[model samples]
Target: MNDKLDLQSTDITAMNIDKIAVLFPNCVTETAEGKKIDFDLLKQELSTEIVEGNKERYRLEWPGKREAIVTANIPTTKTLRPVREDSVDFDTTENIYIEGDNLEVLKLLQESYLNKIKMIYIDPPYNTGNDFVYKDNFAKSGGEELFESGQIDEENRKLSPNPKTDGRYHSDWLSNIYPVLKLSRNLLKDDGVIFISIDDNEVHNLRKICDEIFGESNFIGCITWKHTQQSKNDERFLSRQSNYNLVYSKNILITKNFKFNRTEEDNKNYSNPDDDPKGFWRSGDVRSPNLRQTLKFQIIAPNGNIINPPDNGWRWSEEVLKNKIQSKEIIFKNDNSGIIRKIYLSEQEGRTPENLWDGNVFGTTRIANSELKELFGDNVPFDTPKPTGLIQKMAELFRTENDFTVVDFYSGSATTAHAVMKLNAEDDGNRKYIMVQLPEASDEKTEAYKAGYKNICEIGKERIRRASNKIKEEKIDKAKKDGLFSEFKDEQDYGFRVYRLDSSNMQDVYYKPQDYNQGTLDLFADNVKEGRTAEDLLTQIMLDWGLPLSLPIERKTISGKEVYSVAGDSLYCCFDDGIDEAFAKEIAKEKPLRIVFRDKGFKDDTAKENVKQLLKQLSAGSEMKVL
Candidate 1:
């Protein structure tokens, strides 16, 4: 009787089919499942220079490649249920923390966050044989050892080992990350970027896969981050002290130039010794970097001393050099030996970011361990956690926008969240973070479990909480020391909303309505699952409606019926029973842009039709949907 809400994640396969149908309508045909692309016919249509029949091509592939692709395209009925009890500032915070499998979580986010994220930074598993635990069809038959060892469970959602003894050691890791990367690409804006951390063991393979996913042309160079300075004497050859962060942009043409904020150390070279109009200037080389005959010239100083050009050439031509000298941009030494070009501090943008990062600027592993120790008091929650400074530096490279979003799927210890908050507090920028981490269980014998942290998500959430307080205390201490305590305004967001991925709220009968008969209707009266709260249904509805979960929500009573208003009437929802024409008319007077209701709320068919017609007449532009 009413338009039902599509309570499912975005169907990527359908979208691909629609795209193909637009280009090749003749190759699209209706099937029992739905509209499907006729691949054979489509291939024939593009047969001009098309490779087929196992022709060799440049690609990174492995077993189950097709299955991985299918996994990315498949739609999910799963949804993120709000966990307000575990969240901080649940009603107002823009930051989010989701606990779930990254792959499924990425699928659920396809619609609401498509092309919305400004940047992504993930330190995924380096796959040193024992780190891989993602269970998928990539090595189903070869996981006998893992199955016998009790690594995999009935739901296939637990951590399963991908041992090196297995034949598909690298293949399993590839398959696990491939679909996640594909789904992540959809969430990046046109000018967005992603930084992936890896080690020597899988850096080569990671780069190849990233090149394929983000396009070879969009490769933005990898940074070798030195995480430690100490050398291990027990190494087989040499002690490795550095890892890599492969950078890529969604589109290279629109990506901004990477740079870091200029620090006090970077500006120490500039001075106003000459007291020129420019604030501060540093001497720059006036010689050309490469040989050029036209630039080879001589210049006369104010003391009638002619100085010969450098071996290669002068940086500027004769006339240009004369103009620069006239403008006093070029000056001679006290002895009139050579000319010096003045590089003013005011003219510089920032320090150019290098491919090699080291020292405390990027934070060492020792410092990271110490940071955890300081927060947790010797009982460190995680081993080898990344430093907040490291992620902060990576975020600084994005000099374009300040009010951007950063996502970290492998948010071990929530370092990315802490870094974002720290950066925001430092500069008063509006940067938000979305952390997605699988709740890998902590061993009972480990310190984390002894500290009452049952899983990785628990550690991540607690870290964020403690880090938030620590950052706030530091800010307060600095403000008081500077005698600016009263004037200081802490605008940084030190809170995040928590959501856990779970099965859909809809019952099995909701998806299979045709399977029920008139006699079976009594057993399946309510389509929604039992114990699902109104907030749970609202969350799913927002996702299905392609609305962000960060929007403001308020509950109000209109004509004795509770109505939920989102973002000031951008959406309105009421799942209560006993809805009649009076409530519909009253809610329609609010003129909501979108509204929803429970179909069973209506008393009879006539009442449902009457309420629907009244809403249409009152709220002409409002879209009405039902659950």
Candidate 2:
């Protein structure tokens, strides 16, 4: 039998069980689904004390917690189909835009993007009663009310509003987000970080789950973003003008320091008053942040005047302080009142990000609305859009690399894509982005719907296109105005490849051949779906092989058969019918690292054996697979 493609998302649950089996074989037991982790045995192995039945533990629990966990581990048969008509650059662009349920999208990305993303930013439903929350099947027990409420999409995705009156309001919201977040965690690099925006409605519950998911030690900090200076005086009590941004890292040890790009204002305090050879310097506080008895000793100035340490003590140790004085880093005031530590501008890495972000610096909701108004004109399409500045600031705080990858699952209005392009245009970097959004229908009465934008995904895709054009035009205008048009050729990527999640390209018989008897074998001649194209098969094959969907694809005809070359020989695919020895030899001569073919494409059994032997002789290292 030829090698068949395993067309499904990664089996994360099985992988985890295997990992545990290596460490604790006794904790791994057989179940109906093969090998599974025995939680009772695992607990006993992890704890020093005796583990009993139904023991109480500290955890964030809801009605459907177990279901939520199970949902995250279950692999999906879904695949991402490329949409060339909706895409900006279908073949060459490294960026991606997927229209689908983010939970399924995240699961599909586990193998291809595991530990690869540099940053992630999400603005999920705040569960503010009015906002619609994702109504996962496991998130709620019954679906009659949801169906009657008329919130299910054409694809059967439930989108129900979580009113405060509902008894399972909090529990439903928890179940909805828990699985998506769990899957998202697997895609982050060791030094990667995720920033989630929320409001007062569910911030408490959000933090509890985040602490449980990312671990308490990995909790970075919560930023209080003052979105609007004006207060809502009509509120029952005090006005709520700010929202919270909860930041977390994949590994705290890998990414401990978060900083933002230093601005002109940030560097204004630094000056070369004494013309120090090191460079412009600013006075830094010598006091320690926490109490340290060993660093509380007094220091003798060069003039023999004793200088007392601050209340908490010095920032550096006595030996380090002596080194600093010798290096002239610590200087005494002319009045001998206190010591001033000279922090050189040249030595400063970047401005340390603050927990409190002001509206003027970050962005306000009003600013975000204005941005949408400018892009879409009088009839804005989306509501509650986040300004590009806010997302850009998060990337800067993470100290994003020039070629870093950013993902936004809840990509409302595609602001994250807009920000990535904006940052690249400003710095001439080649950053990439992936924006995944659900195709939630727009209300008929809404202006967006009236403007022919049928769903939220339409608005998001149009937003990115409009934003990309605007950014490119602005860059050209500035370059021309400054008389540097010829030399100012920006090579940054301002395009994205569009993909929509759908059912696998393969037919049922391809996955379950054992179920079909010899009598029904003739019906399964063509394993692929009827409407599927060559590109669709190649895309799914790439995903099944753990290849990124954004990789460059080149198509060419060899020996009268159309073949796809992915990333220039990283992978070669030929789903065409009628494969023969000549075609196989022609393909193998290219020395492709991996090759795939259609099993039924060969002329006969003898022909298939000849092609296989030819490939082995021509390209010994090329891994061959069949569909």
Candidate 3:
């Protein structure tokens, strides 16, 4: 029995929600925005998850998936070593080229660049039968990696081909990629996005992982890019000519702001036939998609000919039709067989980008290979590299400002890097890039090895060098012809700093000082490795301080001791052999925001304290430390 009460004017939605809450109070919840209900909680209240004998309604799983999760969370003690000889602009460039394992590199960068990267575009191995999967070995120390860099022979490489004959073909590929994606998601800003390229071999699995990593709601779209122009006769059945670029955003609840401007051909469709004041106009069919008996009527054309309504019906009601006709917006053809509604060109916001990126609009594999071959003087080692135009199209949709940063961990042949530089040259933007590549050794039997390239990273570095020089040269030629380079002369920054992942500069004592016995305690004095240079220690210290490796550095002598000033005195390091109070006062006089002095540089413990106290006295706002 229920108590009867007088009914009142109320909201149907609130009443229905109250009824649900009365029956199941657990389903109701209050969100930060307002009172709301969690659908997942409601499902739990209903116990629908176990409706079919405890089976999951939907999920994607595979063997070793748990291991992948564990691997992503595992901590590492690695540091990046600055390689000046291998860098284009070792001290000034804002771009970075890292030669090492991408997963380890991403892990080390987590603190320094967390939630900072704007866009990422990676062309990873598609897990095809012949593709190579990274054999993630967490046991290997960073020192081991440094020693084995660029010498990844067939037997020693931490990679193996995943042929279909292998029992865990798909599983191995999944494990190889799962950790990298998980780590990469941590590096994206709130509005950041990642574009992953894959073929049919693993597109489905990749989508599942991406959905889990970047919530399903953040899925932007799966773009179908035409990779090849012609049909392949070698295919057994369907001739596949396209691949997918799965895009996901860190947060898509925000506005997309994606706009694809109409081409000249599209604008040609509009014409000012009557020379209207609102500019050119185009005629469209004046029919609605929905039909109703009220809209089913006959019309009389301007020529006195009767015309019946379309099957769908007129787009406007009787009153609306009369208003349009009075305004002269409803135009009749010369023959008067039909009617049309005029659409002004001013209201158009260009065409929206579709998922299908035709090969003609962007370049195909044939064109890409030809371009690469011509650029490299007839040696295109890569089988399929994305054309610069294709990447530029998507790059513009995301970031176009000077502060924008694009990351490409799997930067094969550095096409994305080339595209970034080209976009900067075209738009005069100062975009930064981070390119990471494994020094995967080339087999002696391959043409790349015979062409004087020892590893894949060599090819990628050379490509960036050639592309940067060419872009600069093209800009100079154009500026010279147009005579408009008053400000553009010194604005181009087409250089990158090269850093390789290696062991920490701090010797074993830095990790656990208490574990050293009397015999090993003597070795702990000046714990940095023997061969490590001042630059190497400076690089590690920068990482520990969460500073970007791309910051500009300046070297000068202070009181007869060499000091490296990073980012215009944002951080200063004096890794010299000796440090007296006189030298410390000289460094303090410069007033660096953050400064580090070598512990061994001091004559004694009292000398270190005197220098630290004098620095705090000289510049109270500065942070002073001794390593």
Candidate 4:
């Protein structure tokens, strides 16, 4: 009996070895160092490490979930561009307003937009006592409950502050921000940069988190902006008047290509009075210890009187001085007190921007708010909106034209989108913006909501509307006055396509014949609504397929019904019993990889056979399913 058991065990061991060999073709290898390399062992070791790493990550993780649906359908309402009556259309204008939790939106954008963004600027909640916490609730059946509530009212809304007294105060903030930062990093190009606005409360935490997310090597300098000019007397301790903007890049090595733009103000200081024919030039001190070592030098005046140098010696070496004099580069002052040389603006290169940004050129929040009030009415909805000048300065430093896409996920009042629009309009450039804001209700107790605003998203949409209207009106007025209008029509110029987060449109319809009821039939009928084209359903199908969200779609009419195709591969269709042999043949001619159709679309048994035959003829590898 023991000998028989040993034989059986040997057979089992041999069978296991054969299975392993089939699973891992390169399991055994001989290294050049005369050592045996077991790929199977190496893979097992790596898998163990991965499992342990995942366990550690989960151990430190906070409990929360995203409240947004990742889908493929780009919101048609969000792409509102002014239609031209006569002028030829060119590029697609993108000023996107996504109505969803930004966390899911970031994930949805990961595939098509990885390493494509130029700059990301976020003005998240400051974690102050009044700031609303992002309570993610995904357990609800109908998509995101908070977002599905549409426009929230002040009475039903909850905007609690993240007080320090709370046990999970810091953890909550970290949980809310970690996934977002990690996802946003994927959207940044190699040289892409991000600027985060924060207060003293979470600056240290933000720095540590950013270092971990963006890599410590990618950290740039932190900029301190004077948020408030006045120091409050009500505070017992030192009053805080500044906020920090932490900057980081995807890769500092790639960021070396970035250059600061010289403003018009900086260029205005240069002049060309001497006409040295060297273009523009700027003056520099001519004296240096290595070049000019003499303690003093003598200068001969036009009147033949000898002028002694002051405490400082000559600006250049004796040889250089002789060369300048010979070339007539040096000039004598008319007063005979000293000799001054002319500097040409064309002769000098541009200067680098300094760390300190003055409020004059890049206006402060006060100026920005005042401008908003001027454009809209006296009562602005939100406070502390960043100025277009400031964003423009940053944009100039990072990118140009449509070369990069900019995102502001924590877009308060849509200021970053407004700035992007204004910048593009000024330069006729095609820089795109993706703005995401929660539909949190405004506080009726505060001055803003009491003035008739309901929620934060309402304010954002209104701002975009007003800004578009103003830009269109100005352009029309200018065109009319200049007589440059040759058939241009101003047809609602500025608008963004609006998309709200929602679940997959597919319904679970695998009902048994015995269990079929009126409710199931009603759901099926509702799913196949009339006037809704197949393209709409196909878009939702693509989302369910986990395909690229930005896939190009095309539509064609077959048997008087529209059949939608995505990426020339997936076909989605639905129609009443009119789908016949000819229709199936035409659809199969496209050679789709997958075909989806409504169960009731087939006319009879003959129609199903025709579909099978067409698939065999044109698309042999095609898979078919019924919704």
Which predicted model would earn the best TM-score? 2
Model 2: ten consecutive residues of lowest lDDT: 136-145
Q: Which digits, one per residue and each the tens of the lDDT, describe model 3 over residues 106-157?
A: 9888888888888889999888776565573333445455435532332244
Candidate 3 lDDT trough over 10 residues, lowest sum: 146-155
lDDT at residue 299 of model 4 (Cα atoms): 72
lDDT of 1 by residue, 1-627 (tens): 349998999979878877897999888754424356767778879888764545557887667678889989999989999999999998889899999888888988988899999899999987887666767433355455554444553344346676654546767788888899999999999999999989987788889999999999999999999999898899999899999999999999998888787989999999999899978999999888999988877778888998988888988889889899889999888899888899999999888988999956799989888888888998998975998899998888887568999999999899999989988888888999999997777777889989999888999999999999999999999999999999988877888999999999988754366777876777567888899999999999999989888888889999888888989989999998888888888898899999988878787778788888998899998988889
lDDT score at residue 107, model 4, on the 0-100 scale = 64
lDDT of 2 at 440: 75
Which model is ahead, 2 or 3, in terms of lDDT? 2
TM-score of each: 0.85, 0.86, 0.81, 0.65
* Candidate 3, superposed: residue stretches over 4 Å from native: 1-54, 136-158, 284-344, 347-350, 399-403, 480-490, 509-519
What TM value does model 3 have? 0.81
How does candidate 1 fare on TM-score?
0.85
Instruction: Give each model's whole-structure lDDT.
Output: 0.86, 0.86, 0.81, 0.65
lDDT tens digits, residue span 565-586, model 2: 9999899998887898888888
Clash list (residue pairs), candidate 3: none
- Colliding residue pairs in candidate 1: none
- Candidate 1 Cα outliers beyond 4 Å, as residue runs: 1-56, 136-150, 153-158, 297-311, 334-336, 484-491, 510-519
